[model samples]
Target: MEEGKPGAVAKVIRRNPKSGQREFGDLVWGLLPYKTERPTTAVRPIHARAETVQELPMFADAFRSRRAIVPATEYYVRTETDGRAQRYVVTRADGKPMAWAGLWESFVWPGDRVERSYCVITVEANATIAPYHDRMPLILKPEDWPVWLGEAPGDPAILLRMVDPDVIRCEPVAQRRGNR
Candidate 1:
């Protein structure tokens, strides 16, 4: 997936309120057409900080009602080395897919058109990723999926914790991925 760009679609899994079953679908990368008090406001937030998602005006509503999980085999991060950008690929140490916490929203544009989009939730970096960046996606364990998807009735905030550093592996790679 293209990082930080809008319109890129990704597969996501979310809980269906009516059926109480997990449903899979494609969602646009960035939240858009968000309503604001000012008619000229333009905002497309790509990442929502997990620490304040429950209180942030842009994400609070979705955080409470539309939490989701983004399953992926790996993700990329960039760092500066010798004044040049260096890229790194991060994956689970056990060769398993990871579940990233996310929030989704449906917005209607001016012409009665509707679109659904989502943003990845990020938390402070753990020891493994701190050398590359100060923030990392909030990776949830399989056992915590039910709680995060609201299948169980516990506080979702508790699931925002970072993954254990030992469970993650990072490797430097060629910087040919894309422009940052």
Candidate 2:
């Protein structure tokens, strides 16, 4: 549950500004726009909805051009049953790592103080996740990586609209007293 928590450092894949190539970099798990004054001064958002990523003020610029990918072996989701919370581990059926669609931002201040963070893009839950939650990260297949990362030519909006429900596999996790 603490894997992608805010303030945590995570490996991210985004286009290299200088070389226009894909590069691996570390970024904070929560998004902080350029307007933000400090890392902890704002309640940074960790997820951006697909339906609004392109239109909302918070995500428009990054969604349109600063897209990134978060490669993950698995992610957790939750549901409520009998007034208690149930958790599930979501992964690809083929066991390959998933490329979760994301957006990144960088903030630079005087004296070269720089900070970067990102947020996962969420789309309406597919059949596999509908029973557990209403939203899930926008999972980008390998083929679409280019377009999503701006490494190749293609439409990224089409990807945000929908994802095949059968792509991921989820398994129930046993609950612990203090885990949520």
Candidate 3:
């Protein structure tokens, strides 16, 4: 799913400890299921800061127990220059799809209705993406996917740090296809 928009559904991967297997599920893009009582003006967050996911009230529980990964071939960022907006596509230098770190949660509304949603985790941008935006999604290395999915024992927070800049490359692109 593209950044800055909500309601997009994407495939998410997480570990099923009960079966010792990895499972795939669909999740709505913007997280923290909206409540009927919430003001119409309230905004739902689509991204969680990597540095604070473990402590923020909305993300803490999910950070500990529902970590996930969102696979992507590339991602886009927008930058404004002299009143004009330009888009840039960022991808791995190795030409491989990326596993973006994320968190998921299942919200139970009244009447036992359940909604599963997720938010991409972002950290301070590395050099490759710094010019386009101040933050970028945490892209995990293949070797660390098991750890991020909780298939192995390790600290997710440590894995959330910015990846080395050399692994990523960005290029300016024409206007994106959809309205976004």
lDDT of 1: 0.84
Clash-forming residue pairs, model 1 = none
Ranking by lDDT: 2, 1, 3
Clashing pairs in 3: none
- Tens-digit lDDT track for model 1 on 65-103? 899998888888888889998889999999999889998
Task: Report the C-alpha displacement of residue 1, candidate 3, in angstroms.
Answer: 11
Q: Model 2, 12: alpha-carbon shift in Å? A: 0.4
In order, the Cα lDDT scores of the candidates are 0.84, 0.86, 0.82
Error of 1 at 27 (Å): 0.6
TM-score of each: 0.87, 0.90, 0.85
Q: C-alpha displacement of 17 in model 1, angstroms?
A: 3.2
Q: Best by TM-score, which number? A: 2
Q: Model 2: runs farther than 4 Å from truth?
A: 37-40, 175-180
**How large is the C-alpha RMSD of every model relative to the true structure?**
3.2, 2.9, 3.6
Ranking by TM-score: 2, 1, 3
